[model samples]
Target: MRVTLSLFLAAGLAAIAQPTLAETLSFTLDNQTPNMIVQFHATPADGGTRTELLKKKGLYGGQSRKLTIADGSDACVYKIRAVFEDDSFYDVRDEIDFCENDTYTLAD
Candidate 1:
């Protein structure tokens, strides 16, 4: 009985120690506006610092860039920000679902 209890306790501790794996989401970003998209950022929908996706590159008008992001949690939701070369920024306002959505477009 003691051996069985120890086995059960070990199993319970192992289960508790397991960490939640992050989910990866990939989608296409389309630029329809006339200005060039200079910077792009994504962050947890709840509240977190934005991480740049462009890697010091820029997306021009009529161009599309594929982006891949790992969700910190299972929600798969993120806040997207796009800055243009014309000194303007676009805020998605926290409604983007990177998991379910196939594409995000920036327009005038």
Candidate 2:
């Protein structure tokens, strides 16, 4: 009986130790000229590697955008860039933190 009680308490304590996560994080970019192209990439802060999210063409002073990445326990950094066919590019980046573990419920 004592061993079971101790195990139950330990599990409850462990559950309380987890952290919560934010709902969303997003960004937009401004392309320099008409019909300019851009690429969106994310680089995890853990020094893993950079992943390409998107590429598109834009109008003058046009916009490039991206949405949610995935439901994962790891925090990551993201970067966006405008790349031209001529090889000229401009980049913007930011980092977002995520919960490694958390108890959550869906919002209706």
Candidate topping lDDT: 1
Error of 2 at 55 (Å): 4.9
The digit string of per-residue lDDT tens for model 2 on 13-101 reads 99898776633434443343554454444555666456554535332344433334443425544433445555666554444342231
**What do the candidate models score in CA lDDT, each in turn?**
0.83, 0.46
Residue pairs in steric clash, candidate 1? none
Candidate with top TM-score is: 1
Residue 28's C-alpha lDDT in candidate 1? 91
- In model 1, how large is the Cα lDDT of residue 66? 95
Give one digit per residue, the lDDT tens place, for model 1 in 14-85.
Answer: 999999787777889899988889988888787765678887789999999998775455557788889888
Query: How good is model 1 by TM-score?
Result: 0.82
Please estimate how well model 1 matches the true structure, expressed as its whole-model Cα lDDT.
Answer: 0.83
- CA RMSD of each candidate after superposition: 2.1, 10.0
lDDT of 2 at 62: 49
Q: Over the full model, what C-alpha lDDT does candidate 2 score relative to the true structure?
A: 0.46
